[model samples]
Target: MAGCTGATSERTAAAVHGLPEDALLDMGDFAGAVLKYLRRHPVDRLTIAGGFAKLSKLAAGHLDLHSGRSQVDPRHLAALAREAGAGEDLAGAVAAAGTGLEALRLCAAGGVALGDRVAEAARATALGVLRGAPVTVDVLCVDRAGVVVGRAAPAGPPERGTAGGAARQD
Candidate 1:
């Protein structure tokens, strides 16, 4: 279900950027919201920034991050962990973790960049969702403390801090 936190973040971002409150949107559907907004607005660069759990879902190719529509699949994450060169034990732990954040923590402790992999996967997924919409999409996973735990920068004109690269700072 939608909550006040997302609305509050959107409003805060809009206010801080001096844009209209509606400029930054969160209707609980990430891909739907972007697609709907794109229908009326001309956007070149899009940044998908939010919690790690939903970002993990995005990495797993879920267009909708709502609890009703999708969930963070630990098995998919375990596969990503394996792709990141994590051992089977770690992958098993990730699959057993209660949340995406826990899986990330396990990867971090094991010197694996699971978040980076997840971010890149999420970026690719977002690009696929856009389907040649001429938008450069970046996926960033930030924790509650305002730390950029992971990021996937798309190839595009450099603006703000977006450069083509995978970021992992656990």
Candidate 2:
């Protein structure tokens, strides 16, 4: 697992899961970091742990996963909320939410698993990178307090999005 403790990290999850992390999961390039770790150590499965901001970039298929390189577009998040069964009002709230975590909370309060959707999207992106490498990927969306708010196991969704038109570069 990888993700925080510092401002750009949620290393609590990494510590809990016992991942050897040496860089910030946010700006170090999340997918790149995972692949780099794989090149050395061997692991059967992979877990990506982070909050909404980090995961949102992954969900949007941003390999860089940095604020400057890729940003969390509330409109895309709102669309995901709608796809997750959030009503118009709640979706609008997500669009205007102050922070990514706040938007996630709004979706959760409205009984929508926005983070799950995001995790699944991120997993799909990772699988694309893996390219049938026989490794399964799981993504966890953790809140700042180190609570697991959402998850997407490899066996969960068949595929959330592809490395195609579904992913938004912006």
Candidate 3:
């Protein structure tokens, strides 16, 4: 799993059953590491779950999940807040947030289920990334508290405007 926070390691292990071992990788090496592992192990199914913002980038086919390499676009957060029916002040606050956690907190304060929305977005992006791959792909969104806020399986039909498209709050 690609993630920006320390909690991703524990959360991913809990979510993916039968994971024999885990390896930590930097954002620059994440894609290469995954490819190497797949070549060696050849798993039938793969599940990727992590922090919402980092997972979003990974799902979008970007290997760099580092905060510096890939950032949560403030405009996207603002848009999501607006779609969640946030007031202008809340939207502005989200837009100004410097980190994903801050943005999430702002959303919570604004009465928006940001976690769920992030999970959906990450799932869509993961689907897009794994399109046509032999292995099944499942994506989960986990919050800082190690709570599962969103999940998606490969069996479902892809939703339009998802898959690295515009940010959708629904």
lDDT (Cα, tens digit) per residue for candidate 2, span 17-136: 666655335434556556445535535666676666777877777766767777887887898889889999999999998788889989888899998988777777665555544455
lDDT of each: 0.66, 0.67, 0.55
* Per-model C-alpha RMSD: 6.6, 4.8, 5.9
Candidate 2, superposed: residue stretches over 4 Å from native: 1-27, 36-42, 156-170
Candidates sorted on TM-score, descending: 1, 2, 3
10 residues in a row with least lDDT, candidate 1: 161-170
Better of 1 and 2 by lDDT: 2
- Candidate 1 lDDT, tens digit per residue, 54-111? 7787787776778788899999999999999999999999999998889999999999
**Highest-scoring model, TM-score:** 1
Residue pairs in steric clash, candidate 1?
none
Indicate the TM-score of model 1: 0.74
Those runs of model 3 whose alpha carbons end farther than 4 Å from true positions after fitting are 1-7, 10-44, 59-61, 84-87, 153-170
Expressed as tens digits, the lDDT of each residue in 1-170 for candidate 3 is: 33223456444644455444353323232642453354355445555557666654554445556666666777676776677678888889988998877887788877787666666655554444444334444556667666665566543223322233222221
Give the per-residue Cα lDDT of candidate 1 at 33: 55
Candidate with more favorable, higher lDDT: 2 or 3:
2
